[model samples]
Target: MPTGRALEDARSMLLETGRRILAAEGTGGLTSRSVTDRAGVAKGVLHRHFADFDAYLAALVTDDAARIRSIEPRSAGSTVDAVTDVVEQVFTPTTRALVALVISRDEVRRRVRSPGSYGIPLLMDATAVVMDVLAAGREVGWIRRDADVAALALALIGSAHLLYAGELGAFPDHSATHEVVESILVGSL
Candidate 1:
């Protein structure tokens, strides 16, 4: 059996391979065999670290959430710019694929909704960040005072999710999506 450091390294390697596969082919192209074969690990390595495929997926999504959380805005930007940066991060290829995979698989969706779900914590944190930015924008008269911040945040999330799902990784240009979201957020400005 692999020792402590080796075990962690192995798990990380498997997860990275899984992430790449997911990004390239969506969930439909991912499996334990595929990950293990691509990762050059024993077939049972993934099972040793996770209870099952769903567990592996949950861990993967949690890893992604941590990465997303690290993309904090610098102090040099307007609230609208900051918000647009965050939205762009969500629409990145890997993130989009991961979210699309989670939504398509019933078992993975259930796992992500369970107690202590990583998705919930990430989402709550993101929503709070958006709300804070919106409030700040309102204080500065950047965002209209009557703008519904919470609804706006939800709309952003929904639009990005739908864009990823509808395109299936083939969206060559999201200028239209960006334009729409930008208009919605700063239309009155």
Candidate 2:
């Protein structure tokens, strides 16, 4: 029955609570009841905003994907550094869990995935961001002109995801992220 700002706050509260649950306990701990309890909202509030839990999850993943797309790769240093920055931004605990949630649930994956697009939701968007960085590097002579940016982007994203996704709650440090980026781009640059 909240009106105006309270109504908006209710949805934001639900989403934020869901994200915290995902970060702390992964997708296994997230449920409609859990979200409602954590957000201090009634169960019907979630249903009122979203069709079901899957739809709410889709919104969450989609919201995160948009964030990934908005990240502007750092261009101040080496191409590796730029790519590393973007990877770091994309590989946070919440994002990592969102990626897992997308992979673990078939319906949520389908709902978040764009038509005709193939790849995991958040990771795929991160790859595109890295590809843009690599393309810029190529343009500026930092990367080899003949390098296959698509493959390189994929390699970087997949390898970094493995490195970051290996441990939940604890993210890899900058050195580890740099190592992954440098190793993948060593030959291409």
Candidate 3:
């Protein structure tokens, strides 16, 4: 039973709770009731904020996309290290579940799909960030000047998604993540 402002701001709470459910049990465990129950709010609070469950999911995807775009690549090491850091940030269990959810639900996909944008919501943004990092690498003489950054970005992000999405227990360690990134960039860098 949240009061006025708390009720108004319950959207973030609901979204965070949904993210937790998604990370803990995957998309199959996330529902309006689960979100409300986890947030300690009434179910009506969710509906009051979002038009429906799909709408709520769309908002979650959009919020996550913005978050993905805001991640600054680590500048402490090689471009490989920086890209690896970005990939690790992007491929969390929650994001993987959101990707699965976007793929599974047509309405949620349509709602979150940006006009003229391509690929899955969170992954698309992740690719863009990786591309930015690669582009910066090119400018700094790390990546090859002739490298096709868009294709490289797509390959890196897609391959990392495959590696992370299939994991049922512990996520791949940082060394594994670094290896994947290095393998991909070995020729291009």
Candidate 4:
């Protein structure tokens, strides 16, 4: 049996591989062979750490999601710099990757069923943080107060999904979406 340190090393390598594959390519590039190749580890290493690609991906998604969730919720500043900071910092690469996985039927199902950190509670927790951010923004008079929090959250998630979609990825619609969200919140307030 490998020592704890050895196991951690292997897991780290696998995670690195997963992140690289997903970032440079996309979900399609994630495979045992690809991960092992990228990680420079033996195929057995992956099998030891994960049941299969589905299992490995689920764990990866969870690990990365957790890291991203570390970004604390705060009032979004209106300045371009402030908004950019939240976007780039809070929505870190891992968060984007996790969101990509969430919108995918296959990935989300695997994550839900998998025995890992990316469970329903985790998803809901992340959603709650986002909802809170929106609510706080509205309460502070930065967003329209009357905005339907639930629907706004849904719209935000949808916009994130649509932004990452293949064909329609090029539509400069986030500004519009943001405006709508802010408008709704401000209007409600």
Best by lDDT: 2
Candidate 2: worst 10 consecutive residues by lDDT? 1-10
For candidate 3, write residues 128-164 as lDDT tens digits: 9999999999999998999999999999999899889
Ranking of candidates on lDDT, top first = 2, 3, 1, 4
- Scored by TM-score, the top model is 2
Model 4: per-residue lDDT, tens digit, 61-80? Answer: 66755664565534346522
Give a tens-digit lDDT track for model 2, residues 40-60: 778999999899999999989
TM-score of each: 0.78, 0.94, 0.93, 0.67
* Clashing pairs in model 2, backbone N/Cα/C closer than 3 A: none
Candidate 4 Cα misplacement greater than 4 A, ranges: 1-8, 73-75, 78-110, 113-126, 144-146, 167-189
| Tens-digit lDDT track of model 1 for 82-183 | 676666665666677777666667786676564764444345445656667677778888778888888887666666556555555676254755565676
**In terms of TM-score, how similar is model 3 to the real structure?**
0.93
* Number of backbone clashes in candidate 3: 0
Rank candidates, TM-score, best first.
2, 3, 1, 4
Judging by TM-score, tell me the better candidate of 2 and 4: 2
Q: Candidate 2's error at 162, in angstroms?
A: 0.6
